[model samples]
Target: MRKKWITTSLIAMFVLTFFAPLEARALADESGKVTFTKGLDMEGVKISVYHQSAPLAKENVKSLCFLDSYFLETGYCVTTGFEVGYNGSENSRFVSLTENYHLPIDLPATGYIWLETTTEDIFVEYTVSDYLYTRDVVYMDVFVPGQSVTVFGIGMSDASSLQLGEKIIDGKNIISRSSNQITFKVPSDAKPGGRVFQLVNPISNAIPVYVSPVVFNDPYQPSQWYLAQQQIYEAYDVFAGESEMVVAVVDDGIYLNHEDLSSKIWLNEDEIQGNGLDDDKNGFVDDIFGWNFLHGNKDLEVKGAHGTMVAGIIAAEKNNEKGIAGIADNVKLMPLIVCDTMGCDAASVANAIKYAVDNGADVINVSLGTSGVTAYSEVYNEVIKYANDHNVPVVAAAGNGDVNGGIGFDLGQFKQSPVCNETKSSDVIGVGALAWLVSLPAWANYGSCVDVYALGEHVVSTTVPIYDLEGGLYTAADGSSFSAPIATGVISLIKSAYPNISNAALHKYLTASSIEGILIAEDAFMLIKEQYTSADDFVAGEVSAVDVDIQAIFSDVPGDHKNVQAIIYLQQNGVINGYPDGTFKPENYVNRAELLKILVGGKGIFPDAAMYNNCFPDVKNDWYAPYVCYAKKEGWVGGYPDGTFKPDKTINKVEALKMLLNSQSVQLPGFVDVAPFEDVATTDWFASYAAKAKELGILEETGYFLNPGEEMKRASISENLYRLLTL
Candidate 1:
């Protein structure tokens, strides 16, 4: 909220202002004066200038021009030439010329020169210039071979003459050509590898092209509706999870030798297996696979069915013709047994958390909660805090108290447990169970504290073997307990893919990417797809840190700008972009089209435009048409009853804030004694948004005014977007 002033120096000011007049003069000739429109003296090695609308004594006559005097401080001789061409529409002629000069090595100044023509006199000023370098290139979207796609050469001068890798195509290959898009077929023989498609006309350098192949090859993936529903399959196509990251299932015990789970279990390489000694001494002796906090040893034998099932949800081996596919295909599961048949105590669970954190667990899954314990205790809170301090995410289950459609069973309303307390650290994600991947399960808890919902009703996963006559090893169960692990698995996938990502960022990514309301399976998948794809642009899995250069993404955002970091973060995450020039234009006010695009793309709230019926009269065929249509379809934004979306109009501060809050499904807080802002009245349309923004601390309290109807600037929106993402 603090303002930072950016000042331009006097030398820079002189260059910009003084160069403008010279550039303008180079374009036009006024008052019958023969002037050098480019500059008084050509300072650069290579220079070209145009004398516009100059009166010529005779048409189509050759004019000889030369620099009157020269003293070279540098080595080469000065050369100058001029050519006269008709101005076409007017009787006046234009003279264009290139001047090349060299200075002697010892001379301090280049001597002045005056030009005398047969009919006129021209004045020349002497000044030393630096060399100029320029490269001409066209931008185009590259596609996979054999696909007819529309590619836009946004800044290309002559798009019609564009060629693909120096090869020209026939008319049959060209679908259509317009000012904006050039629809063409990529030749079947176009090889896929590097992105280098050259343009013939205008002589552009090689341009980058992107091509992605759609592939799904998991053997048992078809049976796992949950994976496809959440679009984990698409995510896998980009990043199928990594084995380097470990997810610790802090629960009862896992069936370590299960056919689907045996290969994927975490092994402490430092500790010798079955050594019966304190090998890699952290605390416990012979903790090979994982520690058993319940028995106080490394015996990981399964006593309860819950832990094994939870472990399978996080990581069951994939493509081994197994019973089911876990959310992550390449993650290592550390089974830390904390309970037996009776359930775990605070002390035992805390120890398990410590064990997981000390042994390099990137993520911890605590699917069990103390249902009888209510208040925050040092024993449990300290351990959870250790995980938070170590940058490990702890996923816990929201207690299952739903009886009558989650009416009185909300976690916020019920304060009956310790581990599931509302006062838990924000690092701990409390997950609620959803039936049919949409509604809250009959036994699932619901509340504002529950960060997200996952499919927990009748969830099928690996379980401990029941050796009776007709029993199977795997089974289907229902509870928030199961949902916690599912959410944990998803987090594990993200963590594995982005190993260096902070715990806070991981939490934000998961919650922000989660689908709201009755989450449609396909919609959830789209959200996951977006997250994975957005993250793909960033460098991941590096040993050190990687900084994303804002200039690489947005040309207008200088690396030294105050808000450049926030702008780069949002831009890399696909949150915002209003211009095709690769410039963010941060000083410009945000428009309705831009806002809707950010909400839909960044928040992952609305589906693609193709899924909804078009209703906005003014948005059809517009660049932001899809976002506008999606917003209207979801009722996040409403148009006039007459059916129009004035998308180009600048969005006000209140309207922008409300749409952002609405996109995240954040509810406005109840009335309080203090008003949110001096300008916001309770009866106003955006009063709730203002109040909620204040309640969330999104709007600064000190020296901050709610300029309600004022247009929101791009820089202001970038800051707000950072808040929304980090929230």
Candidate 2:
């Protein structure tokens, strides 16, 4: 990419040659001299140009003569783009125009130019428009370690009189209009990355502030996506799909009209549009295409939809020309808007469930849930049963409130009114949040109903429609609210690949097919579309179709047994362990860098590690530094800050993945995706090694040359080692 240069003098020469007649007027009116005025200043250089007629104002003429001369000398000129301007009372016949220039446009500062002009004469002014630009806008200037700053800026507004203002850095309001800039110092007690600005305008109802386009080195790089490519890659490749699954997000609603998620939306082909009649006639009226359980109508508004984020989680169009990609790129998303202005009622939620079940939803995603007793008991029982009966699996979030032995029983006893006097439904498949690094968020609910977990930190997703915007895309969110959609996407992947699997069977398979140890056998098979006469009919004895090789998983020792006794014990109790192979090979050296992935696969925990990028001297893109990052964050492992994690050195297998899964009440499987190698055999001391790998669908046959006896090279084992942890 060679830089192109255009000199003003060259353009001037061309313009003079082409438009010689126009410059003839500059010869003067009566005094035989045309006054050349300085309009603006560049650095210390002032620009002077003779006033020319209208035809000479064209770009071709300006570029060749006036612009060419000015630009060649000072590298500045009248930008051929839209500009913002205003008129002042002092100059009754004068209008002031401001030239808008994009940032990093070879300018010394960030400000717009204002030109003054009258009917018969034009002159450039040195005035600049009152626009605010800040370094914080380009870079996420997180409050320094132990600091928490709250930056404020203008939001969307429609009022004419309203103007954006600023506040003091120390939480005080700016009294004078002259003071429009301020910084809020972070309090020592405030936690970093949790605070965001709340911009409000007193005059307008609301205002949508255009995001400033400035690139700055992210202070929180260790926590951003680019730096955690391994975790992203792990989650990406595990349940790879051909982009055809339909994940029905039944939430508040969705921006079904959004460009990214719209293409994959499932439209009810059988229904008619706006005919005021139930063309398909499936009980509800005008569900002609996707029902709205909240208003109980077909026409749904974008503002109230909670399902849009969930839709983004499943398939919000991939690496297309716009916005973010979903977990499953090519999938159909059927949005069932079940919430209104007051939020979703239990009855509405249940109705949404029934609608999704009745429709052809491969996977129904329910990002909302209730832990306390609900007034609508029928909605819960009936909808739960309907979803199961119709073979549509429901992936719901475990409520955000703590729900250990059940709601209101964290200390092992029913201590609150809700639990003491009421009962909650147990049929819904509940999911809880497992942090991006490790350890469960204290606020994340826990209960017997909680069936599984997934990444749920700064998890980005879709937002409802923002009207009249050129390219629709918005990112800023968190919660189990996001986790549920991710799980739903995983379900969609499974269903899309094996569509014939019964909803109940598929549900069982998900729990059954999970990475392992992270969930109980029954937990794995429990909520996925299950078939039973009643809740009580789901007894413990019937062996689930998705089976795990219990003994073979525990027998092998990859390293010293005492080191990772906790992980071993979990495996024995069916908490976690390797695949069905007999080789546990604990003594085999583990790559230090791939630890984050190991935790993801071995413990079901995502990581926030500095990516082992391509440019690093000793680290490659596939190195284990990323895994080590998650390990470091979650108290799983440590590395030299000097930028190295000796990954090839043998790690105590037990001490390896357990550091993350332990101390945290999360559950995952012992399924590492290590394919069988020539020297890495089941009988070679690593019992259950091959079986676990095979069970996890991540192995190659023994004859495939896995030279375990040879020292793993930085290049040879880096990528696969990371995948082994993630898979």
Candidate 3:
């Protein structure tokens, strides 16, 4: 779409001709004449006028902004939207006051009329007002209680004192205050809502910051229902992963300066930027924010949003008061550009794969695919194989067909379709798209080749100027291209938690984690509402309901494993483990102390050991002291009447189930109206646990026998953990 040019001068002339007399009073007060920065001397430029009310323009209009599209540079004018100094009988509405790069308007208050030639430079001073001061924070992200958050805004340099309104957080402990941002922490008990921060000395501006009493908030996150459908919230509750792990996004060039993506971009510490020489001597010069393969240089020259959207889905910042919270975080995104204005070059795609693998990417995400034609490039096939050979898993999108009513194709019927066919291996996960209703789209490629599914349509993500045209912020998108990244983010979460995990192991986790069947939109909405209301944070329901087989990861366990999928799930997430000799020993009876260990580990709770030393008489200095004492302190366990924990005793079925449900955060019903087993009544001590387990199908006790005192074995524990973790 072409940029629209506004006839500002003509409109001003026409309005002046009709509304005003022949004589007009153009302001001759010329103390602050701003010379247009020499580089931006384009005549007859259009300016978007958004008038703000008196006293101050706030952060919404800071720092005069210029939107630079091809040949058209639109600058923002925050004013009265009327001609200046025209006091002629209140006739004219607007006039063309601008002439020869100089326009002066009276000061409504104290501020500056800053302008940018390009991205930066030039200022117009408006002096200061003795009666009222004008200052505001540029922007602030959602603040978590007891965590440091930065409040950035314009004109904070003169603030001598600061105060928070309504007693949300303490205004005393400021880490530091720059001209742009102030760093501080919110009180642990601050309630969620709008918070007013006043810069005092003489009081400038009181800006409202989004204060989240809970941990997470993103304006568009509720629209991001894919996170709910994919069980990403539950995965994050277990592990958010680490920043050391990297996922290389190979696609069209990304908007490096995107607000949501800038901080998460992977930096090449070895190379210096823009010196025109290869400081690292690896191959490319000035490869600071990963390589821009389009021109084989550091200049990203991002002309599209495909790459930015894909990368955002993989690693956009979470809980930021931005557009949307991306799936994965605490992981770096290596932008490996392989596409341009025309399209992606096959050879460039191959080179990007090699570069990503060599530079230590944990996984490679390719959203590009042969949409319509049955075109198979041997070069892409070789690179995919090369990536797998190096143990760098590759995830690609199954084709979204073509522009002519993109019909889904079963690539399994053919030998090679770069999107799906070449990606059926253990190291290559071919992804298909799911609609908002959790139903597969008719145009989404699905067959023996498409390995898994993720929400594709209406996926809200960070965007660039090309896609949005509004530029920056976010937009909802469709197609299988997006599904691949959501899957890639899940892989990123696992890889970040366990950097040493094998790609083949990740393949099993990824495949087994997904479930089929429809979850009607209304049911999902109601379930999510209850979870959010009752739970302290976001919770994701189970993804797949299919019973998955666990491979023999231990010497004692057979390849055709007998138990549910949780053993590998737990092991993969760094929750449970086997003996040093590689034996799982499934029959081993879980001791009281052992049960505490498993429960605590499953919850991903790691309290400081220093705080729990010698917590119990019999648990002093024991290996299980931390877990046992922490559990005891949380009221999940109690000591014997003799005041001894009796840590060595075997755990019974009732006790194990209670601990499992509590530690895993399974919500207890308000009232246990009916007992699950004939032997157990509503008044029984373990009735709630038993009922919850029965409702969730955690136990296979169809006969309704309450074997309350039976010893809980390692295998039974694994099965219980699986149901709780997965379900």
Candidate 4:
């Protein structure tokens, strides 16, 4: 058998990505920056229905934060000062001061500027210097009337003498104070209407915040474990939805008239239903709700169970004594059939995405995946990215189990098309299936690329009456496919509440709020069996979790260590070693040299030092020279921008993932219009790399920020490698 050798070139390709210089930012001495929006730049601002505020073109909208660097965001969904959770149909979102909306060119560039808002209007305004934007004093929030609520945007910690629409909320009512928020109790007598908050000690002009009661009375909501696991209930408690938030379901077909889904069907106002003409002038003829891209006709019968199940999971009528509750209480479902009994193809799927974007879909759910399809299609990825560029987020399934049958396959094993296309499109949110609440379901196609996970086992959702139905209203469905709609439903709800939230920010919130995916070490080890031709080549002895005594080897990894099995496997194979002090600092960060040694030694690669001495100007003829030079010669490692490879420095998750995937020749996901991470922007160099890493399941972190520059801890590096190994 050929020696199990890890190509040093792959590590070299990733080595250049490791030493990313963190720019030291000047300490901002400024306070909260606010941007007074259009139609509400003064106190008691009100607008007449006839007021035709100049609408800013979507492309021209710009936002500025620290360093005076402005980034473009669509005017339709740009961040504004008014963060109200009320109904959103703001037309003149263009601003007058600062970043969002349309900032009038004539407004004062700096210094004190009064911002005023009324109970009728909700928006944001510039507070501090134009440079800093850390705070906004008061943001739109619901006052629960007697219960303490967190008003998140206020920056003033010493702020006191609070008043909600002339109702004095004394300083004593303040429960706690933090940098970004001040939790305070609302007056019991607070009326149920929009109220502007006022505070003394560094006065702040605030937006109108609507306070009202919110609740979900769906009878069967309690039975759905997915809702709780995904924090759907918590999201609904804060923001309500509207019918305007449309989520297009591109599937084989949906039961358009299902009892629970009938009312939620999106009606095309421009098209005359039953009329054979292209009444809407958009595209298809008589496309009242959604068109069928498959047969080229509008025969949207429930050809299969998947579409209806997906639709119900997205926007089934809620609190209507329905079979079960959807993630979004109020959302419109545009059922566009792009598949038939033969299953979905590239051309039709692309058309469906284009249709959804053009036809006013706030979110798109493609709860489908290929079982063994390995063909590449740029058209499929382009359309997915196009929708993302147009502010429509597409949520897709990671996969059911294996790219084969149910045996199990890792997306890392090869390339997955459509679902995670070649570009690693930031727009497509690949959702994995989580079973038993915490486990990444065995067949979920669990890999380095799935963005998030949701309950996908034994889920109850609306199905056609002709099929297997539960209570004659719904059926029990299972698959990672269902997970897409679950995420889409949440996106629909959020889009309606914060109409100004861009798809990028919406994506950030979605993934950041996700339950972190997990894979125990023993299971991780077992899953990697397919990666190796022989069991002895992978692990020496039995694969059971009970056999490994990690403490006996490293004296640091306890029996309960999450990665104990992996550590044992690596240590026993002569891959990794403890410190001379006889302790394996699992929590310690792994540096470039240590990581290369672990991986190279694990793979049993023995490079001829004389032939591989000169790797780079920085990578000298040291202990790591053989691995670096060998990889460099093999075209695995590329020199950095500065023409040097810093193999001694530490690396982050993104660099490591990019190196591993690139080295293995794993097909990376395609380019997306936006970067999903809050801290990583579209223009960042590591944006696509980071996104690709995320798609390949190399980065399993769930949060707003990727913290891409932070050092990779030893255990995290092990977990990441293990993920790649099993993937």
Per-model TM values vs. the true structure: 0.44, 0.40, 0.44, 0.42
Q: Where does model 1 exceed 4 Å of error?
A: 1-223, 369-378, 402-408, 416-425, 467-469, 517-727
The digit string of per-residue lDDT tens for model 3 on 1-727 reads 1112110000000000011112322221221222121112112222222111121112222234222222133333433222233212332111212222212111122333333222223233332212111122111133445656555433355776665556534455676776555777666665433355666533134544434333357765544556655655555556444546688988877788788888888888888777888887779888887887767777776757898989888888877787668777677889888786677766777788889987778789888854322356555766766665455788888767543247666767643345643422353678888754345565676776677878786677888865676654677678888988888887776656555444544554555444562212223223333323221232323323323346666667776666635565555443455653456678899999888877776664544454665777999866578788999898888889899999999988988999888876679887798878988889988899898888998885678786888899988887787776666
* lDDT for each residue of candidate 1 in 631-664, tens digit (9 for 90 to 100): 7766789986677778898998998998888876
Local accuracy by lDDT, each model: 0.57, 0.41, 0.60, 0.57
Question: Residue 597 in model 4: shift from native, Å?
Answer: 45
lDDT pick, better of 1 and 4: 1
Angstrom error of the Cα, residue 213, model 1: value is 17
Q: Ten consecutive residues with minimal summed lDDT in candidate 2?
A: 5-14
Per-model root-mean-square deviation over C-alphas: 30.6, 25.8, 20.7, 29.2
Q: What is model 3's C-alpha RMSD? A: 20.7
Which is superior by lDDT, 1 or 2?
1
Pairs that clash in candidate 3? 137-153, 138-152, 138-153, 515-544
How many backbone clashes does every candidate have?
Answer: 11, 71, 4, 38
By TM-score: ranked, best first:
3, 1, 4, 2
Q: How does residue 292 of candidate 1 score in lDDT?
A: 85
